[model samples]
Target: MQIPVINRSRHALPEYQTAHAAGLDVRANLAAPVTLGPLQRALIPTGLFLEIPVGYEMQVRPRSGLAYKHGIGLVNSPGTIDADYRGELQVLLVNLSDQAFVVQDGERIAQLVVARHEVVAWQPVEALSETGRGAGGYGSTGSA
Candidate 1:
């Protein structure tokens, strides 16, 4: 699906790295490098604004390479960007490692994936249907 986007940053628009890639790699649009000390978080902008079609939303996710190599991850694993939102796309990044990490301009910090969603209508029900393992909380099932 074709999306309408406005890129105000110096870098080009984000695109899929591979033919089968699901998410487009998003970069940081910073005037200067921002350093993230241990356990510190920052809201980095992308200088991008776009409109998503109704019934769909944009998901902001962390890159696996960054998480594995530098212990860099997103505060909100999969942040939702509503279809109605028309503001600059920003990422909430956190440094999980003990050392500091620098967020350079045009660095591939996060990814943006467009997803389809359903509008659910709440139905007032007296009770939910019983399952084979009813009310089974975490770790209730056997570890295989």
Candidate 2:
């Protein structure tokens, strides 16, 4: 699926690193480095504006390498970008480690995944069908 995008940054547009990659890596569009102290978070801009099609949304996710190596992660994991939004794409990054982490210009900070969604209509009812494990929630099943 081809998407209409406007890139104002000097860096190239976000692309898949591998042939089978599900998400495209997005870079930071900063003039200078931004340092994030431990447990600190910042909204970093990507200088990218996209026009997502209706019935679809863009998901902003964290890079596994950055999270594993530097404890850098997205404050809102898998942030949803609605199809109607026509603003600059920004990532909410946080430092989970004790040391400070610096985000450089054109650095790959997050990823974007375009997915289709369905709008559900609520059917108000008093009773519902029963299940084998009714109301079973967190840790309801035995640990294997």
Candidate 3:
């Protein structure tokens, strides 16, 4: 699919991949750098402002290699960017490891997947349809 991407600065739109075999990484621009502390907290910045189309959203997710290597991850896994929002994308990162981490400019912080969704309007009802494991939540099923 041809997604319309805009670059306000001279920096290029985030490429999905390089010549490397791994998936492409999203990066911060030259202006911002995200810092992760031993406390496992980071303030991630959205390199560019986006205008996503309606019915679709951009999901911000962690890179597996980074997660495995550095123990750094997005605080809100699969963070959601609504279509109606035209703002900077900020990622809250948590460093699961014992050391500090730094996100450099043009470094891939996470992957963004543009996805389509259906919004449902809620209506109050007295009862809901039953399911196989009705109301059984929070590890109701055995963890093998």
Best by lDDT: 2
All candidates' TM-scores?
0.96, 0.96, 0.81
Over 21-130, each residue of candidate 3 has an lDDT whose tens digit, in order, gives 33335676647566687766766665567778889888888988889999988888988888877777777778888888888776777888888899999999999999
List model 2 lDDT by residue over 1-144, tens digit each: 989999999999999999999999999999899999999999999999999999999999999999999999998899999999999999999999999999999999998999999999999999999987777888877543
Candidate 3 local Cα displacement, residue 119, angstroms: 1.4
Task: List candidate 2 stretches off by more than 4 Å.
Answer: none
In order, candidate lDDTs are 0.95, 0.96, 0.75
Cα RMSD (Å) per model?
1.2, 1.2, 3.2
What's the CA error at residue 8 for candidate 3, in Å?
A: 4.0
- Give the per-residue lDDT of model 1 (tens digit) for 71-121: 999999899999999999999999999999999999999988999999999
lDDT (C-alpha) at residue 7 in model 3:
59
Give RMSD (Å) of candidate 2 vs. truth: 1.2
- lDDT for model 2 comes to 0.96
Residue 35 lDDT, candidate 1, scale 0-100: 99
For candidate 2, the per-residue lDDT at 121 reads 100
